[model samples]
Target: RDLCADFECEPAEFNGAANHVHLLVNLPPKVALSRLVNSLKRVSSRRMRTEFPEPARHYYRANTLWSDFSFAGSVGGTPISVLRQYIEQHNRPV
Candidate 1:
């Protein structure tokens, strides 16, 4: 979706648990990590509120959804296959 159009990266895998979501994306070289995270949070928050107004109203009080803090890391030096396997294994069932 937006990730594909905006960053030229499609999410390879996605999983969500109680308090967090895990996404595996293949990012283009020019994309900045912080910018990507901010855009994702902003866009998804807005879209979620608009598309699911009842749920958004029940859960959130403000216009924003995500917290200000985020965690990010580079996958450099790790084999892609191994990383994919790791991400696949760690996901919690919905």
Candidate 2:
């Protein structure tokens, strides 16, 4: 979305249900995973609360809409086909 584009990142894939989101992104080499995740959560949460009042009501008083922690793995040297297959087979059902 706008935030991703603004950060010079492209979200290549996204899928999720009610309570979670999965994003596969291609980010500029200058962006660190920690910073990128923090920005996404912070900016998106702010936008959500401001622009979507009704849904924002469900958010807790804490200044957060997503969990503070995230899971990440290095994909170095891994083929896309192999990675996708592993993710689809073992991760999709999660």
Candidate 3:
């Protein structure tokens, strides 16, 4: 994705539902999470506006495509396999 290329990060995995997405990104230590997140939100918003202008314009007219708050957790201690499984599981039909 453009976000990864701009930030010099790699997307190890990606998944999503109707309202949200999960991205397992591998980025450099020098890149701050806040900055990356801001870029991600910006890029996503731009793409949404380009791809689906009507809804994005209506729903995000006042705010943004993403919430002001974001949930970010470090997985320094978690195994990649487990993380992959957990993320994959969330995408399954409930």
User: What's each prediction's TM-score?
Assistant: 0.78, 0.69, 0.83
| Backbone collisions counted per model | 0, 0, 0
Model 3 global lDDT (CA atoms, 0 to 1): 0.79
> How many angstroms is residue 34 displaced in model 2 relative to the true structure, after the best TM-score fit?
0.7
Summarize candidate 3's per-residue lDDT along 9-78 as a digit string, tens digits: 8888877776777878888899898899888888888888899988887768566777787877667978
Best of the two (1, 3) by TM-score: 3
What are the Cα lDDT values of the candidates?
0.76, 0.70, 0.79
lDDT of 1 by residue, 10-48 (tens): 787766565677777888889888888889988888888
Pick the winner on lDDT between candidates 1 and 2: 1
- Model 2 Cα lDDT, one tens digit per residue, 21-86: 667777888878777778888887787878987777676456667877787655678776665554
Q: Which stretches in model 1 have alpha-carbon errors above 4 Å?
A: 90-94
TM-score for candidate 2: 0.69
